[model samples]
Structures are given as structure tokens and as C-alpha cells.
Target: MDDLMKQLHAVLAVDKIDHNTVVKSVERNPYRRLLQEVLLERKDIIRSRMNLVALYETEEPSSEIEEILAQFENPTFPLEEINTEKEVEWQPLERKYLDGVSKIKEETTMKQTQLEKDLAKSLAHSEEVLKKHRDFRPVDDRDFSNVKQSITKHFEQAKTNLRGDAATKILVLRREIEQQGRKRRNFDKNTTDTLQNWFHDHRTNPYPSDQEKAELAKQCNIKISQVNNWFGNQRIRSKQQAIRMEEEEQKRLAALAAEESEAMQTALAAASTVATSSNLAAASLMTLPLVNPTMHAMVLPGMPQNLLAGTAGFLPQTNYFPTAGQMALADNGNGQPFYTDFENFGLATQPDSEQFNNYLG
Candidate 1:
């Protein structure tokens, strides 16, 4: 049964989709029909055993009742209704009947065990039949749900039995097929690229009109839902990326501005230090006495160099005499000195005798 389920699952995985066309009539797999009959016969056997169990409390064993009981007890029993497989896994019915207040429950328990064993054998046969003839079971009167409800009523823990296991596999396959049927189909790369081009062209208004979406769907070999889903995801992601880029740009600009500001501050600090030192030097010079080298060089020829150096600062600008180096009384290297009235070797207090005396010196 497990092996057969694997085979069926493989088939389902390959055929992910089923056509949606419906018909009033269609040929079903005869093997599945046979399995259905087997289930129905099992149901009837259950009804018969229940009646036989009730009848056992009053009457003795009858041939018909005994015949019905033999089918459940032995899988190899010859049957006139259908060809049964002789190769069946047979399990003996083991029970420890206690001194119970209700023997009917015990009787029912035995009946359930008998039914469970036979149902497993029937399922094993069905599995074999499925290996060759498994096809899509259309939704109809012969639905597995009816079989599930009928069989599960007989067992307290149906999930542990083979009937439950087969039914579970079938239902799961049906669900998978239905879900795959409703799933959104994928498009090729060209189709997605076309959609991307449209999205970019309409960046200011990416939301497509209904008619535009319909046109796109037709052009792209996709459905409207696929178009809508793609556009929605694309718009959100594009905005998110744009916002990230803007944030990164802002951060870059801020870092650059901070660097420029720091450099400017450093340059200003160095320039301010230089300016402060220059101002201090200028301030120290402001308190010193002044002197003129040109005035000292313009001393009278008779005056000593030391005397001129000492008194040149007190001499008025227009009243000065040549130094000894300019004198022609001895052999001077330069031409003869031209002593104007202001450059005479005399004091500015000259009047007559005293001035003449000063001039003579």
C-alpha cells in the first residue's frame, strides 16, 4: 500500500495540472470500479456480521450467516460474485474476552477486528490494481468521501488501519491537485522583461489601468493576477531602493561637509596663531625709541662720528652738517664739499662774533 501511494504521488507530481473541462459521461477505470464493488461488498458483509452477532444470542448458527462470516475469517474463500486474489496477508483474530457486564461490546469488538483485517486485504488488492490503471477519479457519486465515512464508522481508530491510510493518501492527492490547479502560473523571461519595460516607462504612474493590465496580460502570455502581483511587488521594492539610495547620498554629503568644516577649522586655527604672533611683535616695536641712519650720515665734516651718532636724533631735518669723511681740509677722496648755510659747522644760535667763532671751529 505504501509503495502504491508513492507511485500515485509521483504521477501527481508530474501532472501538476488537470484540465477543467467537464462532461456528462466518461469512462472510468474498471479496476477502480471493481475496488468500489469490493468496498460495497465489505459494507454488506459488515451488516451481515452485525445481524449474525445479534442472532447468535438467540438462535444457533445458520448456513447463510456462517457463509457471510467465512469471507472475513478467510481471504482465500471461493466467491461466486468476483474473482478474488488468493495471495492475501492473513492475520488470526486474537482476543482475551473478559467477564464483562456487556458481551455485546466484545462481540462488536471481534466483528470490528474481522472487518479491519479484511479491509486491509481488500486495500492490498486495490493497491495492486492501482499500479496499472490509476487515473483521475472525477467528482461523482463514487467519491472516496462516501467510502471513508462508511469504513471509519466501524473502527475506533481508523487512522491506524489500511483503509484509513489509503483514503488519507487519496484525499491528500486530491487536495494537492486542486491547489496546483488554482496556483498562479509562471511566465518566461521575455514576458517578465516586457513587464519590467512597461513598469519603467510608467515610473510616475506604475499602476496600470484595468484595460492596460488586460492588454499586458495578453501580450505577455500571463494572467491579470500575475501582472497585478508583479507590478505591486515591483513598485514597493523600487520605492524601497530609492529611499535607500537617497539615505546613502545624504550620509555621504554629510560626511563630506563634516570633513570640509574640520579642515577649515584647522586652517583658521593655524592662521589665527600666525596673526597673533605678528601682532605681538608689532606691539613690542611700538614702545622702542626711533633713530634715523640717513641723518647720522649727513653730519658736518668737522664733527666726530661718535658725536653725530649721539646727537643726530636731536638734529632738525633741514639743519645738518657733513661728517669728517666729507672734509676737504685734508685730502678727501670725494670732490670739494659744498657747505650751504644750513650745513655750516656752526650752532643755529649764531649771531655775529660767537657765530663766527663757532663757524671758525
Candidate 2:
């Protein structure tokens, strides 16, 4: 039936308690009761190394304890604020923690008041006695011990936050390093273009000096090794290309010369044929009168029609006839050596040797 109360785990000294006057603190602030469960001695956490700020900050806010958190968020009263040196037990609480889950009724009762008095006396004497004999701090004064512990804890927290920030920064730097590695392996676009332009510009002597290579690497944001490799490969490729082009050019010239030679041989053969045909035609024309004035052509009866007839369409040789026949044995179809009247088939006059030679020429 007393289950509405939620536990409070102290984040810092005075995170739970209100004042050094235990009677007033327990009576007025029932929810601010301190317990031993959160102390280093009671904690089961590893090494008992506590980080209170981290613990409290990470915990989900309890709607049941909204009133307590609100005061913690924005305090108005002195008691609403975290306990300071003014509180009798602030020193002991600053060094440790507080855990409590007492029912609201129990916290408000006289029994809780007596317990708070006893707790305030333990580890911390009566505040009146401290001020009278032990030189207790003034109400407005700060405890150097509390201040030192706070600075130390905050510095540690800041260190942890800074470490997280450092982790993120390292990841970004790692990505950039990877990007640079890729650029080194596969040359960047700007560097490629720059190198190509340089190569073409200095085609006569594409080599670069050490200083020039250094400048190129600086401008391209790349490594010297990459630049060196590019030039070496380009030179080799250019040489191979030049050799291939020369071979191709030679092949092209040889093909042209071969074509020209073949054409000349064809022309010479044509001219030879024409000259032979012209000489045969000339011989045929010279003998035509001896054969017959009216005849255009004569193919011998026993000869094949395939005789070289391309001499002015047909040729007649005067050697076919016999000379000096008076009374010819004239069998017309019996292989006869016949003689004809001077107007018809007659003895052929032999051409003069000098005239024949000159005519043939």
C-alpha cells in the first residue's frame, strides 16, 4: 500500500538532503532522506569507481519523482538547492552517495526524524559543537574538499566527452586517408589531365626534372611515385605506338608501289599486243592487191578459220600460191597446184628483199 514512493539515488553530496538541522530536514523534506545503498561500500559495481553525474544523467526521469527532479532542475529555496558546507553531513555525503526508498508516511513520521538525527551525528558531529570547538565553516563559505572533488570529477567527465569527440574525429581522418590512398592508386582526374597536357606539350622531350616532378605532385595533391610511374608508362606506350605506326606506313607505301608496278606491266602487255596486231594488218593490206582487187579477205580452203584474223579482220598471205606455172595441173578440188589467168589465180610475184625488209620495219 506504500508503493507510490520512488527511490532516489544521489548524484552528488546534498543531492538528497536539505540541511544540517536534521530535525527540520527530515520533517520538512520527507523525500530527501539519505540511505546507505548508494555508498561506495554498498555498491556492487566494478572497482567501486563511481561516476555519479554520468549515472544520474543517463537514468530515465521518474514521473513519480517529478517534484524532486524539478527542485534539482531549478531550485528556489536554500534547502531546494544541493546541500552545501552549511549542512552538517555535507562533507561525508560529498565523498560518497545516498540511496533511499522509504515510504512517504515513514519519512514523515517521528521515527525517520530520529534516524536522520542519528545519521547527522554519525561521521559528522553536532553543527553547534563544530562551530563552537572545531572551527566549522560559515554558512556562506565553501568546503575546499567538496570543491576539489567536484573539479576532479568534472575534469574526468570532460576527458571522457573529449575522448568521444576524438574518436569521431579519428574516423573522419581515417576516411580521408582512405580517399587519399585511392587517389594514389588511381590517379585523380585533374592530375591525369595535367600529366597528359604536359606530355603532349613536351612531346619532343617528355621527361621532367626532379624539381618539375615535385611541383607537379604538389599541384595535383598526389605522390611523387604516382607521377614517376605515369611518365614511365606513357613513354613506353608512345614508343610502341610509334613503331606500330611506322610499320603501318611502310605497308601502305609497299601496297601503293605494288599497284603501280602491276598497272605498268598491264599497259606494256597491251601495247605489245597492239603493235603485233598493227604489223599483221600492215602485211595483209600490202598483199591484198596481189590476192584480188575486189576481195576483202580469203581463208584457204584447207586452213582453219582460227588463223590470227584480227589483222584488219582478216589476213591473206601471198606465200600460198606457186610461182611460174604455164599449163597448171588444175584439179580444182584435188590438192592441185593450179595456175590462173593474170586476172584470177596466177603465179605470185615474190616481193623484193630490200623492199620487204623496209616495209616490215
Candidate 3:
């Protein structure tokens, strides 16, 4: 009996109404006709099942049997009469068989298991279908060649359902496309040359005038606001780069000054200690007093021979101590040191004296 029911169910399921098939009929609820057509097509099998169901409940021919016989004799039959008998016969029997608490629980558990299994299968099938769709790269060239065709495909479904308004939408979209295309082509042609010239001419200082920006807008067929914004961004970028370069120059000068100062301090300290010890050494040698001839040859023309000989001879005389100013001058190679001027003026004077004078003024 269960096998027979399964066979019957399969037959009923196979008699499907294609959900995608389009039918242009006046009636909107076309499923009524669809069900009738399926039933008519499988009339012989359905009639046999109805008879068996009736006989299983009661071992006799009922009013349902009489109705089934009448339907076969007359081709034109109402579904209402057949449905009425089937509902009355099946309702009591299903309720009576599945009434107990245990029976209800068993049936519910069985149904839930079946539903879970079906859901898992459906989810897997959906994932597989989605994977195929995701992997599929369209080989159809017409898909992208014309923009309007793609838009129409995406939006203009259900031709029968669409009223008069769709034509207006397509017309408006086309006009917008043409206007935008014209604006872009004009902008591209003029913008490149204008920007290149502006950047080149203003390499030293790149601030643009309002009049220049307006002229750019006219040439490019764009708004003045767009040119203004581009120049504003360029100015900010240029300023940041200038600031970075100035900072790097400052660090380099500071390092050079530090190295020079350390070397000068070391030389000054060594010269001071040598002068202090030479006085004691010269006093002890006074008992064997002698004049050196090489000392006379040290005096030469165009050289500070007197200053150098005096500094060397004075080191042996304990009574002769030069002033702090003279000591500083000696370390400075007998000329005003570059650092002294820097200390006074806070920077090295430039080599161009006229420019330095002008800057000072």
C-alpha cells in the first residue's frame, strides 16, 4: 500500500506546471486551469487512486465511486464535486489514525528529519549553482558594447506588465548619456594642455589668479570651482615639500658647525699646556745660555715672522704672559676668525659683500 502511494505521488509530481512558461490569457489566476489540465492528463491513474482510498476506509462503493464513474462518462466535469468527496473521506481517517500523542510525536519527528535533509540538499544545490554563476565569465560581447542594451535587460522585464511609462524612462536616460559624453570629451581635450603649461610656468611659485582659473574653466568647458580646487591642492603639496627641504638644510648646517667647534676647542687646549711647560724648561737652560741662528732665519717678508718668533720666544719667559685677547687672536691664525663674525652677527656673512650690505639694510 505504501509502495502504491509512493508511485502515485511520483506520477502526480511529474505532472508539473512549468512555472517559467508565459501565457497571455485574460485571467490572472491561471493556476486553476493549470491544475485541471494536469488532472485531465493523468485521469486514468488519479481515478484508480481515488477508488482505492475509498475502498481502504470502507469495503464498499461510496458516493465518491459514483462521481468518478460519472466523470469518465462525461468529458466536461466540475472539480468541485470531486474535491468535496475526497476532503470528506480523508479528513476523518487521517485524524483518527494520527490522534494519539505517541503517533503525533513520531510523525512530527519524521517530518522534521525529512525537512532538515531536504533543506541541506537545497542549500548544497544553491551553493553549487552560485559557484557556477560566480565562476562564469560572460563570453557574450554584446553584454557590454552598448550601455542602453544592458540597462534595458536589467530594468525592462515583464513587457506585458509594463504600462506607458517605460518608454519615457528610456528616452530620458539616452539624452543624459549623450550630454555627459559630450562634456567629458570637451574637458579631456583642453585640461591636459592648460595644466601642463600652468605647472611649467609657475615652477618657482605656483599660485594661480582668479582670472586665470576662470580662463581655465572656459578653455576646459568645466566649472571655475574645479580649477580653483585643483590649484588649491597643488599649492598645499608644494608648501609641504618646501618646508621639508628647509628642515633638512637646517640639520645639515647644525652638524657641520658642531664638528668644527669640537676641532677648534681641542687645538686651543693643546697649545695652552705647551706654553705653560715651556717657561720652566727655558729657565733651567739659562746656565748654558746660547743664541740659536735658525731663530733669525724665521723672519721673512709678507709673513708674520715677528709675531710667530715673539710668540715662540715669549713662551720661555716666565715674566711674559699674553692677554686673553692676544691668546684668542693667536688661535685665530692672526686674522679675525669666521666664527667670531658669526657669533656677533648670528650668521656667516655672505661672500658677495654688496648683497650682504643690501640684505642688512
Clashes of each: 7, 1, 0
How many clashes show up in model 3?
0
Q: Candidate 3: deviation at residue 92, Å?
A: 53
Please tell me which model should have the higher TM-score, number 2 or number 3: 2
Stretch of 10 with least lDDT, candidate 2? 94-103
Better of 1 and 2 by TM-score: 1
* Displacement of the residue 159 alpha carbon in candidate 2, Å: 30
- Stretches > 4 Å off in candidate 3: 1-193, 199-209, 218-223, 278-361
Each prediction's RMSD over C-alphas, in Å, is 31.2, 28.6, 31.7
Ten-residue segment with the worst summed lDDT in candidate 3? 338-347
Candidate 1: where is the Cα deviation over 4 Å? Answer: 1-187, 278-361
Query: Using alpha carbons, what is the TM-score of model 2?
Result: 0.27
TM-scores of all models?
A: 0.29, 0.27, 0.25
Index of the highest-lDDT prediction: 1
How high is the CA lDDT of each candidate model?
A: 0.45, 0.43, 0.39
For model 1, state the Cα shift of residue 64 in Å. Answer: 40
Q: Write the per-residue lDDT of candidate 1 for residues 240-326, one digit (tens) a residue.
A: 999999999999999996775565445445434423332212221112122233322322224343333323333332322345423
Q: Where does candidate 2 stray beyond 4 Å?
A: 1-186, 275-361
lDDT of 2 by residue, 136-215 (tens): 11322233233334434444444444334333433344344334323225766898899999899999999999999998
Q: In model 1, state the lDDT of residue 271.
A: 30
